[model samples]
Target: MTGKIRGISILALLSALAAPPALAQSAAPSTAQPAAPQAADASQLEEIIVTAQRRQQNLQDVPLAVSSLGASDLQDRQIRDTIDLIQHIPNLIGNNNVGLGSSNTYYIRGIGNTESIATQDVPVGTYVDDVYISRQNANNFGLFDVERIEVLRGPQGTLFGRNTTGGAINVIMKKPSATAGGYLEAGAGRFGETDIRASMDAPLSDKVLTKVSMYRNRSDGYVRQVNTGDKLNGSDNYGVRGAVRLLPTDRVTIDLAGDYVDENEANLINRVDPATGDRIATIGITQGALAKYFTGTKANNEVGNSTKSWSLSSNAAWELDDLTLNSITGYRQTTQRYFIDSNPAAPNPIATGVSPILNYSLHQQWSQEFKANGQALDNRLNYTVGFYYLHENNWTDLGTGVGTASGFTVSGDRTIKNTLDSYAHYAQGDYK
Candidate 1:
């Protein structure tokens, strides 16, 4: 089936090239007028272009409720991931689970998923370079080298497929340019903090252009694990992206890109006294038992977790007479593992010789998408239509074991496997 689709895609490319020159000449007018030529107030209403309906259109011309954030806004506001951007964008909020890296939930307009299970569904969809990212663990993939981010409000059922009841976030990364240039940024703040980002783009030849970007971030925890007298919460994150643009001729362009990310850290901690619902005392708990037997300590309980993710994408475009054709294909994979301590007690009250409660979990997922879109009828009737498929597998194990106290052993496990395949076709027109 995959081979057949590839062959069909190739045939479509050839047919587009064979289209009549008259059509090409007609479509050429749109590109002739660059966006910069017509501008309103440069600061208030910047000329924003978006692929909301799969074609670049003026932001104001689109009826959908949408907000766009350029690179400058992201950096200025310290927006790092979907979680950090939620408060900045109107009507968006996200919460990180206590000990589960796979269960980060996002709420848009008060609609979202609260469950942390890997098999659970989400109302808001997240996409990077036109590829859908279904898992929350992949959400921390870093936002360096991004060109712009578009948040489309309201249900995008007609175009974005299932699980978009609330809205969708589209993250567009900078494409490799024919010119050679790049930037490097480094910053430091409180709590043993450090951030490094770099990107470079150069032309390999007349037909090929390449771009590479990398980022690294590390910080010392603000909270201390009283049990072990060690830093309880902090993070180490790094990723790399590489893309190649192949433009054999003026009418055809192909872009291929791939990225990988790794994130590690000591999980979060929460301290509570069941009797008083207040802070508990940590006097005798040792470091070895805290690291081996307990998932998380009182200081940063459930907040410490780690994730690793990677993805690849390809975009091919062909310009014909009255219409332009585009094919976007992408795949992503992610793995997340973390542990949390649900309960902490003094004198090991819960158990005779064991710690309180320990919880551990792991999640893995893979997703893919293929879409084709363009405009029609003298560019007045713009449209986007495509088919999407996804398959995900999840494994979760929760366990509580013996601590220095006594008689504390409990465990549970759950596994889920899901596959979704869908096909959709949509068309929208503009009078002006």
Candidate 2:
């Protein structure tokens, strides 16, 4: 939704306070699918805009099970990330892989991926700015600068993809406005916690507009190491997003956006001995390394995890009277690395030390989509047609020290890579 800045747009301002993504306001051209209301008595309640079918319609009018949370709703609830909303949404579970930062497993309606391996697939699909995130390692991030979130339960294999067999998490980012205005905010809390968020929207000439948003958060953590006094389960992360929109003609609109995020946190430990409620002291793990891995309440290992990622996207639309043509292009890259404290309490051990075991996962993807939508039969018939293509490359590297309980040590390494391409052409129509 864009145009005349008559009075004040409260939704825009409130959304700026939270700084959402620059998701386009219009829907992609796709077949008409039945809408199902995830909420009861939706028609009697507030009218929510829905796009589960790749067409804009009211929540109550759609024939699919869907739920939505607007930007203001998320901000009022102080929902900063996916983990915060998981508990509130029914049947939606986003596990952080027992304290690993880069591992996020989302279970919607109890049908998500069970394996933590990077080469596997996720039943529930997640999208940001209409671009499929595909992998969970990059799915868990601060939901700052968002417009709204739509949760569709059940198989969404029609318009989305096979990965959406369980459901889809649709995220729309706030688009840049022709109006020139912005927002800033800061806060502090317990455990040395602090939050800083800001966003700015500006118009360059009559046809070009741009917006930039960023946020930073940190915490001292509640748990600590018994031996080294190091804080566990703490976070230090920052992210930034920028976009430029150009109206080259009366019928054409173009948008280019880029985003980057860096996450560094002390992961929660994964394992603890049941007998003594203590970490298994390994013969190869040092006291300090062992302490760091199992320092906190949810102990697993000594070394935490770190991740860095970036993305670029372009969306263009052309209106041809009653018919509209839309195109989307996207590219993304992400990397995650984590380590664990090896136990030294083996039956036979001469050297007691902590083994540094680490794994690095990387993902790169590019996608293109073209769509056409129009109406016929005295405006009673609505239809959509689209073509989609995606190319993805993923790899993993595992590095660890192989050792025996009898004081043995050897370095081990392994790497694997895979490439995949997908294509689809779809069309559907409905008569009112």
Best by lDDT: 2
> How would you encode candidate 1's per-residue C-alpha lDDT over 100-200 as one tens digit per residue?
43345777888888655556778888888877777665564578999999988889877776778999888999999989999999999878889999999
Q: Which candidate is the best by TM-score?
A: 2
Q: How much lDDT does candidate 2 score?
A: 0.74
lDDT of each: 0.68, 0.74
Backbone clashes for every candidate come to: 21, 37
Work out the TM-score per prediction: 0.76, 0.77
TM-score for candidate 1: 0.76
The C-alpha stretches of model 2 lying farther than 4 A from their native spots are 1-44, 270-302, 341-357, 399-413
Error of 2 at 265 (Å): 2.9
